[model samples]
Target: MKYDFDTIIPRRGTNSYKWDTPEEENVLPMWVADMDFHTAPAIVEALQERVAHGIFGYTKVPETYYDAVVRWFGNRHHWQINPRWIIYTSGVVPALSAVIKALTDSGDKVIVQTPAYNCFFSSIRNNGCELSANNLIYRGGRYTIDFDDLEAKAADPKVKILLLCNPHNPVGRVWTPEELRHIGDICLRNGVFVVADEIHCELTYGRHDYTPFASLSERFQQNSVTCVSPSKAFNLAGLQIANIIAADDEVRRRIDRAININEVCDVNPFGVIATMAAYNEGGEWLDALRKYLWENYEYLCHFFTERLPQYHVLPLEGTYLVWIDCRASGIGSDATTLRLQEEQKLMVNSGTIYGPGGEGFIRLNIACPRKLLADGLERITHILSKN
Candidate 1:
């Protein structure tokens, strides 16, 4: 079935976090990670059927929900998930916080790849954990993990958790199995538990494939906690559902307690229905969506190559977020974001929010219709051309 990714659905009046956040009219919001395209028809139909029931009550998370998750991962990613090992949560962010709370005490350190998803920082901070940056090396317009630096950080006794982002956001490199094995080995040797955030596992493009950190081996599985969801891939962020998979029973129990204490244990009914629908029937739609997103990325790359060659557009191996090196604009990242918002009515994220190594960079979301993406690129050109 052909998915309609070309239509520009009006979202401004609907209280969308991405669309309605900007006060000015004609503001193109290419910032937030959520896609502008509609979710799969299966998800919409499943949701509609539930809405027709009209009884919104506390959700019990039926076995079918677990079956859907287990089947999806087993079939799609070749990662067999036991239904007994699954712990449903409201979102990946909350799952990370709960896992941190369960595994570490206050003041213990959590290591994150620099220029990471900004929420990882907040999750660590909220759990009373200090953040240790194992910054990714930026060279030749690509990002690679600094393994020696990661090893040094992990060797610190205070560092209890390494928050690993597979198919890393903002930077956009999908870690290969070899890199992941090396990382797993270092964390294991250092007694640092791995918290793998694999939410973007399904969104890789061309030659780059996402490797589930825990799926590499039994030893890695025992030492890791993986948080996954259909939210990012299925455009279900608003549904607010995610899962934590732990092969170790004790680890799962402790994290479950933390989840209850943190008060994020409850999930909305829509999230459950949408997740099952997405996993079981949304594959075709997701593939189409990925193709559209890849095209958008190529178009953006071409645009930058032709009209804005000074600004470097980094290669994106996974996820729809594109990282651009904007140092040539002769302005800091924060200033660039402000100028884009105020002058051109375009909204994009400053690289600084993602932490160290993010300076003088900007992250753009290309998960929208081609026309809208073109408009945003033109808006960016209007502002950066002055430089």
Candidate 2:
């Protein structure tokens, strides 16, 4: 209520990756994970102060930045993080790549729950590791981890890591503590390391809670590298900053070396400021934003249920992205996305990009004003009504 989430901010000329990339004339981009809402007031004010100082030179991350991150997880998530366990990187994807390179050989395999964030595939492939997909089971309008497949894959001698998406993207299922423990136990038994990408950890809706992979147990903490960032929660992805928490000393050394080799250690000054501010002073705004995002998702679900019977909107427990099964609409995922863009001037992500189990689905980002969300839903309904 205190923030201006309803105002439509034009981003056409801002070089935004979400808005500027679409070649179409007036396409509404509900595709990307980033939100359309402005960041917290504290973050903006901190950036303004940093810019006003006017000295954009090589900078060292201050102690306060670490303290802010440490305090955030402790206060909000009840996870006590030792500041020594943290490694700064430009982004979570880069951190994932660095972790993969550091922990595994070229021929190693990485386990992933498919219908995941698309970048996980590239991060594994680009690091010269083969993808070992454990496709999640989609049933009863929700997604569940296929633990049997996960165990089988983890037992592979070549599989070295399990890249996790806690409070997962696309099919939004916030892993329960029991699920997290099961995953950690499977990896532990198979000598597979865990790389938990908890970027969407803070955006859970309702009673679903996010359990940091490291927060599960002492043994689990030792066997995992947890990635956290304020960029997704605060809509500051362009600033490019993330923290990699590696409690194991050897893994920490290897990751630090790989990050240096990749040249992603030189973080932008704005990112540092924004991250610290967002974590330290932006909790209220984040709470408000989460409420708005959840409401938008509820509206989307209701719209589909009441107006568009053919489409099945999945249960959205976390993140702003909604996964809708559009197969019943008599269209392929790619065709639906294309038609939405071309016919309705609306943009959404084709589910096939997230790997297997994603076909016949579409991922729509719902972190916008209610009016904009309504417009997108209407456009989708208009198209599906005739089907």
Candidate 3:
């Protein structure tokens, strides 16, 4: 590999949300989605060059930025995006909140697939919209959407938006083109707008290819909004940069207004620089990173199968997050997380926070060096084996 992903860069004193949040010393944090590895060399170099300028003024996004985004998605994923259709924002979470605010009324409803991302719930609630969960079916250690349930939910007149997590979080399943088309057809028939949070699109593994929800059809593109970012792929979450793609003119205008109203329209200079660098020159590094991440996933699966066979690790098609079934422990997800933290000083996300169908599962992030990942897994085994 051209890039080194094996090195363990110390993040404890860096005030990292994933590491510093735990007060205990020597606590291993395998919770947050952000990677333990450093970002692509190109991105780091670009940010350093910008910092050397010392201007620190508000940034005006250049045409080159749009070109990089368009070219990257077009060449890599075959999703052609017009520069005019893109709206830059601070992050995907902010973009989602703004889209919900723009598309729905105070009393309107939004449908979300559960065991979904926790932020999806907060975003919908923050915008004064009701959450209608179309829970994913968990059968035989895999998750699948209940199309009949989704169709029923979308038919409700009050349900104005269907929030989609393409290459889904927590339970990582990259929706196939056929699956995306089915979703699009249901939304189109029910007059529901689609808001696809595809921040994890570039992190897919093996045979799973991420299909941009909007790329399915012209009508789908016109009726939906997509929020994407290099933050997840490049470990640039702190940089706070993302883009919203809305092809419809009126819809784009309303979302832009909501972005400004929400006070997330402006992005920092470093974020812009890092984004352009990542999308333009970071391809090689990203490919290596995905390979490392997939290997880490396989290592985790093997670890579970050997030492912790009682817990079932779900098939990870996309994203670095792995979902493990802890039902055999006969404890709630929150308790399982607490025990891991208190007993082994290892921190991981509780599945209960991810909403329905997450109660018996625990989401573990495996985007770290093999040594660190081994330590986390050993920690889990040390604590859970007692049960």
Query: Residue 201, candidate 3: how far off, in angstroms?
Result: 0.2
lDDT value, candidate 2, whole model: 0.92
What are the clash counts of all predictions, listed in order?
Answer: 0, 0, 0
Superior candidate under TM-score, 1 versus 2? 1
**Can you write out model 3's per-residue Cα lDDT over 60-129, one digit (the tens) per residue?**
9999999999999999999999999999999999999999999998989999999999999999999999
Q: Between which residue pairs do clashes occur in model 2?
A: none
lDDT of candidate 1 over 29-64, digit per residue (tens): 999999998999999999999999999999999999
The TM-score values for the models, in the order shown, are: 0.99, 0.99, 0.99
Model 3 Cα shift for residue 143 (angstroms)? 0.8
Q: Worst lDDT window (10 residues) for model 1?
A: 1-10
Model 3 spans > 4 angstroms off = none
The predicted structure with the larger lDDT, 1 or 2, is: 1
Model 2 per-residue lDDT at 188: 97
Off by over 4 Å in 1: none
- Model 2 misses residue 177 by how many Å? 0.2
